[model samples]
Target: MILLIPAYEPDDRLIALVTSIRTAAPDVHILIVDDGSGGAYGAVFDGARGLGATVIGHQANRGKGAALKSGFRHAGRTHPGEAIVCADCDGQHDVDDILRVADRVRTARTSMVLGARQFSGRVPVRSRFGNAVTRLLVRLATRLSLQDTQTGLRGYPASMVAWLQTVDGDRFEYELNLLLHATGAGYAVEEVEIATIYLEGNASSHFRPVADSVRIYAPLLRFLLSSLGAFVVDTAALLVLVALTGALLPAVVGARVLSSTVNFLVNRTLVFARGTDKPVRTAAAQYWLLAGVLLAANYGLLLVLTQLGLGLLPAKVLTEAALWVTGYQVQRRFVFAPPRASAVERPVAEPSRALGADVR
Candidate 1:
């Protein structure tokens, strides 16, 4: 097992943590990436090395995701098929919890094990508030109920390292992207509850709440933009057609056809194309099926809202707001899902010694 930590401007807490882990599990290989912490923090990295860890240094600070990828590349070349668990260096993760996650990875080698934290009493307000909002948005965006959407401690099997290395994100958003795309790449996320520790209101955390939040929610934002564009097109067509034809059925049909086509093209070409590889016909079919259902549901909801004393414009807005998240979830999970891996990529027929067991 390899314990990979990414540290920047760290203090004795990092050194103490390394020492304690080495004392408890002497055989475990510790790899710490000094993310350009500079000369002042050299003593801490030196102390970690003195305790028998291999410290890799970069001249300039890269983000946590980059540091992790650096460690992963090193592990892939040196340790090859070994299990690796990542933990934060700011003392939030207990060594025992790290070991537990490692053990789970050893058994469930095909799964990505997450050391999820339970934010109960005495949690920092920022931590609590950030997690709560993120969790809700993640659920709406992906239809996945994750207990901890932003936990840094996670375990990855050797088989997943190649795919993990390809996942984009230089900062905190990278972790969220991994979780969001894990299922599409045929990996399941298993969450193991861990203790939540915050030091001095989480001041040690380098996350810029506003900036990082935008990056983390970038996918949802793009989807919203696409949907808004489609809505505008659809509304304009509907009003024009209604005025010209004086028939609701023809107006709705024309508007839906034009709007859905625009939406499909935009989403296929821009929003989801980066992460998805499903064939156009397959995706289009699923998209139209969802659009048909949503079209009916949307019109019905608008009518219902209007009947309940809301104005027509207000009702339309309320109805769109209600279905916006549902639209994103369906389009992401069903329409743009990647195809299953080929036999060579799957290798499910034979037992994978590299992954340890058939946790699938």
Candidate 2:
């Protein structure tokens, strides 16, 4: 097993963590990627190197995602088929918890094991609030109940290294995208409860609350915006077509054709993007199948409401409002599901006593 830590402008805590990890898990290969922490932090990286960790450094700072990708590439070339345990260097993760995550990685080599943090007891207000919002968004977007969407302690299988290298984002958004697209990559996700420690309200952390939050939420926000734009187009076309033709069926058909085309184009290009190994035919077929079902149900509902004395405009509003959530859910699950790859599962290794030792 290998432990990969990405460090930037780190302090003595990094040095201590490296020294302790070396003492506790001598056989575990440690790679510390110095993410452009300048000459002032050179001694700390050197100290980590002296303590038996292999330190890799660059002259300028890239974001955490870039740093992690560097580590993944290095591990892919060097270790080839070894599980990697990733932990934060800001002392939020203890050595024992790191090993615990590492052990889980061994057993779940075909899966991504997340060290889910329990946000309790004197946690920073921003961290707690940020996590709460992100958790809700993830649930709404993917229907996956993830306790910690912002956890830094995670384990990756060797099989996933190539995919990770290909993932987008150079900073915080990269991690969120990884979780969002994990299912598409055909990797099962397992979460293990772990300790949450915020040092001085997580002062050493480099996350920008406002800017980073926007980036993290960009994908979901774009989806919503796209849907809203389509809704406006659909509603306007329906009203205009009704005014012009003075007929209910013609208005509905004409309006729907325009709206559906707009929706499909926006979703295909922006929302449920198609840039993967998964063939477009599958998603296209599924999407049209869903559209057909929704169209029938929508027209049926409109007729029923109109026959029961509702006006055409009111019926259109009610029918569409009913199908809104259903459309979103179907598109997300069927049209945007992650592509899965064939994996060769490796055997689980027993935990070493050295790795299991408690070291704070």
Candidate 3:
């Protein structure tokens, strides 16, 4: 197993972590990526190197994702088919927990092992809130019940390194993207509980709360905005057509036709196109088929609600809201799914033991 640490302008905590790991598991190979730490941090890298870690340097500071990709590339070339466990250099992850995750990866060679932290005692407020929100969003998006969506300690078998390099994002968002795509790429997620350590209230972390949060939530946010735009177009057209013709059915059909076209175009070209290889024609056909079913459901629901004494506008809003989740799921899983790949049979390994209860 190879331990990959991605460090950018790290302090002595990195050296301490390396030393502890070297002491704990002398045979485990340690690979550190100096993500453009520059000449000032030379002593720190040298100190880690002195402890027998192979250091790879970048000319300038790339993001954490880039640093990880560099490490993955190095591991692919040097230690092919070896399990790699990635831990943060901020001294947040315990050496023992890292080793446990590594062991899990070794047993479940096709699974992504995550060292999940239980935020039970004395956690930083920002860290707690961030993980809570991200965990919820990740669960909603990918249907994966992850306790720690933002944990930096993760393990991947060597087979996933090439695919990891292709995942988008150059910052913290990259890690979340990995979780979002893991199952779809035929990798099972296994969690090993780990201690939650926040040294100096996590001051060593380089994550920018506002900027990185935006990047992390960009995919969902973009889809939301696109849906909102389409809703606006649909509502406006419905009201206008209803006013001109004094007919509800024609207005609904015309509005849906217009909005569906706009939505399909936006979703196909922008929202759900990343990492997907489905042809435009195929996606459009599938989208329209789903859209037609949704339109029928939308009109039926709207009609029933209006007949049951709700205002036309209120009923339209309720109907659309009810169908929103279905539309998003169909578009995501069917209309814009990644190219179909043969299923790889995963060996069913014994369940990993949970060391602690999940706090979030």
lDDT leader: 3
Q: Which is superior by lDDT, 2 or 3?
A: 3
lDDT of 3: 0.83
lDDT of 1 by residue, 1-360 (tens): 999998989989999889889988998899888777888888888888889888886677778887787778777767988889999899989989998998899887679999989998799887888888888887777666889988989999888876777676878888988877777677888889998888887889889889988988887778889999998998889779978997766777788899999999999888887525777888888999999999898778866776798875677677778989888867776687655443346332321232121110
lDDT of 2 by residue, 1-360 (tens): 999998899999998888888888889999888877888887887788778888775557778888787778777777889999999898999888898989889988679999999997999988998899999877776567889989999999888887787666878898888877776566778898899889887999999888888889987888778877877787799889889988877777777778888888788878766433347787767777888898888889988999999987788778876887678767765675555322233222322232221110
Which candidate ranks first by TM-score, i.e. highest? 3
TM value for model 3: 0.86
lDDT of each: 0.81, 0.80, 0.83
- Give candidate 1 regions above 4 Å deviation: 273-323, 333-360
Window of ten residues with lowest summed lDDT in model 3: 351-360
Which model, 1 or 2, shows the larger lDDT? 1
- TM-score, every prediction: 0.83, 0.83, 0.86
Which residue runs of candidate 2 sit more than 4 Å off their true CA positions? 240-253, 272-286, 297-360
